[model samples]
Target: MVDLPGFKTFGAASMSDSHLAEVTGVSSNPGQLRGRLYLPPSLQRGAPLVVALHGCTQTAAGYDRGTGWSTLAEREGFALLLPEQARGNNPNGCFNWFTPGDIARCGGEAESIAAMVEAVVAEHSLDRARVFVTGLSAGGAMTAVMLATYPELFAGGAIIGGLPYGRASGVPEALAAMRAPSGNATELAQAVRSASAGYRGSWPSVSVWHGAADHTVAVANMDATTAQWLGVHGLDPAACSTEHGAGWTHRTWRGADGRIAVEERRIAGMGHGVPIDPSGSDRLGVAGPFMLDVALSSTAEIARSWGLVAAAEVRREPAEAPVRRRLVPEVMPANDTAAPPASAATSGVGQVIEDALRAAGLMR
Candidate 1:
């Protein structure tokens, strides 16, 4: 593995660490990664499971603490799987999202995580159909890898400040792509298609979150990632209905059946980090570096989107149906047609800046 000098994880120390148990008996860990788990005291049979990946320089425990995922899992009664990276694998403690072997199907880090998920489900009798994944920064990119390589395993996924799958294969390419992501919708969709070997199974729904003012990873990646999934689902890019909320722009695209297949949220004036509500009765996640207090909780919003939160716990007015425009008419053989859905921090230049800082005795 190529080591990028001075690349460090900048997640601030969390207030309190969550209780996480190490997972054992995982079959064939080719990635040689560590696994941590959080199971509620009272887990129902066939409960849901969520696999969360941590960004570079962050640990499973630290991620759980900062994101409040474990706390939410305990309340929602779902199991949590957190895959940790060893220093030997990547000096910066980042998942090798850009590496070919690590992200490949049935191999390397991807397979190790898959095996961990399999073991957890079998041991806890968790529901396989409801499995979901989400990550931030490098972890977010890895989330795309999982969805592309193991499409059948996840019902849905959320990517926060991440890149699309198959965007880079080496360190140099990764850095360039991070600074300026390149790929038309068709090209991006083809990359996923090539990775999965033309698997025709039902595709997982996608949720994308990004910061408009993020200097680490450019916001253009959000648009690219969205286009990639839109092409994958065969949805019209122009059919989206946008909602303007306070400090954010929410956009949604629906499938033929009218279910939301893709959703994007761009937080105004926010930097590269997961948005959280630090002071609220319904708050989730602690505010820290890369964990900003944007008065909006991505953790809660994601859980609600995935139906993990109880209806009573969510206090919101009913949403009027999104206004969608079908620009193209579908005439499928005059019969029937159906469609399905769908970085990290500073990649590239982020590494350059870190290196300069370290060289100048500005950063350790």
Candidate 2:
């Protein structure tokens, strides 16, 4: 277990909420993880369920408070499931995403979380087809693990500051991948498919977010993640539409049916954290360590993309006619460079690996 920094532990009082309660009686919790469920008062019998995973050194409620996931769930009338990482599992309270046993389908922590999801859906009579999952950093990487191992279980998934699936199989490899993720579109896509072989079902839609200035996890991982999902969806990487905003850039790739199968958001000048807008019209999320104030709420935007939030709930500008075109950043910033192409060899990253490991609290 590694001792990481930048996250504060909340007390038991912070973990208590009226609508939030313990998720127990899971008959197949092989990962030995604890869970909390938040059912909004207005939740209907077939409400949507969102499984939100917190980053390292954070509690479920603390993450819920910072990201406003429960608050959004209340307003949108959706069910919220927060799978917590126990200290016993990882001393840093980070999910064991790189552990082979934990990430394998129907085993270890992945299976434990899957069992919790199944129990919640069954007991609450929720809509199975509308279930979604999302997470931050380590939780975000685990999100990829779940989406890869159990694609049939999720309608959509959002990864914030996370790595691609199967990029690492242990802590040292995980840290090295954090410093620089390796693989091209085809290789990365094969990793996801191989995770769940012999399944020819529809893939879940994906949303990815990363800070341009995130030193903890390089922004290049965002591109690697996007490439992996785009490969899974079989969409051309150069065929997406781009939208630029005050503090971020957004890209979208549509499937043959004209629906967005994979989308990416690159936030300018932001660091390693979940971007939030606490004082926005929606008043979503609180700013804290690893929860940044970027004037754009990832909570609201992600829910909106998921079709869980209504237009009236979010303040909007008049819609502009979008021009379909491919836009690429011509020059990489000083801190972030283009990731190596498919199967590219990597070297001279010892210091970078060390720095990233320290940033993630994975190294002393």
Candidate 3:
């Protein structure tokens, strides 16, 4: 419960028990940036942390409200940090993943985001071993950049409806790649492989979720991302399939080190929106129970398998209640406690008895 200076809480009932704070500050270069922090009501000394980044045309609040991730964090006892993009950073409020300096190993938006993570971790009780990063669309691209540049900082990442990596070329090339039609799947796949090859450490485990019908980011990006991870990790691409669910398919690539696990989830008939229900106006798709269930389920599975979450705890049941009429200890005979079987009765005898009783009582 460390008091964050200049941070304020939002009194929404869904997160009333959590500590919410918004902070605006200058980074190392004294450049201004804004971010939001969601701390659960009861956190361990060093709780796991999740850094959630928003997509285009979305702010921290909009992202939090749209995804309902804050509520999940509150209930699950994890801290959430959201780094916002100011209009000055990108005209459309998107992180400049296309900018040359921004795409580099330690420069531009990548550096600022890394700074933000460092700031929050320094001020909070974050477990260094259990930090995760996730984002959508442009935010997802930025997430890829973070994974590439700051591989040591995050345990893993989830990229939803995003590209494989950001380009260090010019914005025009980046924009062309961003707006490229869905047909050029091969070239896009090559680009992702090239981008990910630059990472220095053991590749981080990654989970990608894409809609089969997503037009904005294009569903083909999932194929490209999967190919990139597989190629880099020397996995056989032919082994992938769409048989996981009726409207869902997945591919997993394992690296030689056995620590890197890359997977893709392709949802049938889905769009560029976060696949959730009861969604806010800012969300991309219809919000419903399914979206949260899917996201949380995926997250939990990853955490549980990766040792990010603790193992299941066992509990003992209460003993049976004492018998209403206890026999005297000296006179009682030992007998099995199991229930006794009743003698077989004539078929329809109960019905006949009930009919007779009803007739005698003049009732049906």
Each candidate structure's TM-score, on Cα atoms with residue i matched to residue i, is 0.83, 0.87, 0.67
Q: Model 2: number of clashes?
A: 1
Candidate structures ordered by lDDT, highest first = 2, 1, 3
Model 3 CA RMSD to the hidden true structure, in angstroms: 21.5
Clashing pairs in 1: 137-343, 137-344, 161-343, 162-343
Candidate 2 minimal-lDDT segment of 10 residues: 323-332
lDDT of 2 at 126: 97
Residue 17 error, candidate 2, Å: 4.1
lDDT of 3 by residue, 1-364 (tens): 2211111211123443234587434355222446778887876768888888877655676677656667667667888888877766665466766666776655577777777777777677588877888887778778877776777778888888777674335544554454442334355435544544465565567778876655456676676666655654556766544335434565666665654477787665665545553432222322321133222233444444456556543222222322112111111112423222112212475744442222111122
The most accurate candidate by lDDT is 2
Off-target runs (Cα >4 Å) in candidate 3 are: 1-19, 23-32, 179-199, 239-242, 256-260, 277-364
What lDDT tens digits, residue by residue, belong to model 2 across residues 140-250? 999999999999999999999998999998778888788799988899999999998666999999999998877678898999999999999999999999877766788
| lDDT (C-alpha, whole model) for all candidates | 0.77, 0.82, 0.58
The residue pairs in collision within model 3 are 276-287, 276-288, 277-287, 277-288, 278-287, 278-288, 279-287
Off by over 4 Å in 1: 1-18, 311-364
Q: Pick the winner on TM-score between candidates 1 and 2.
A: 2
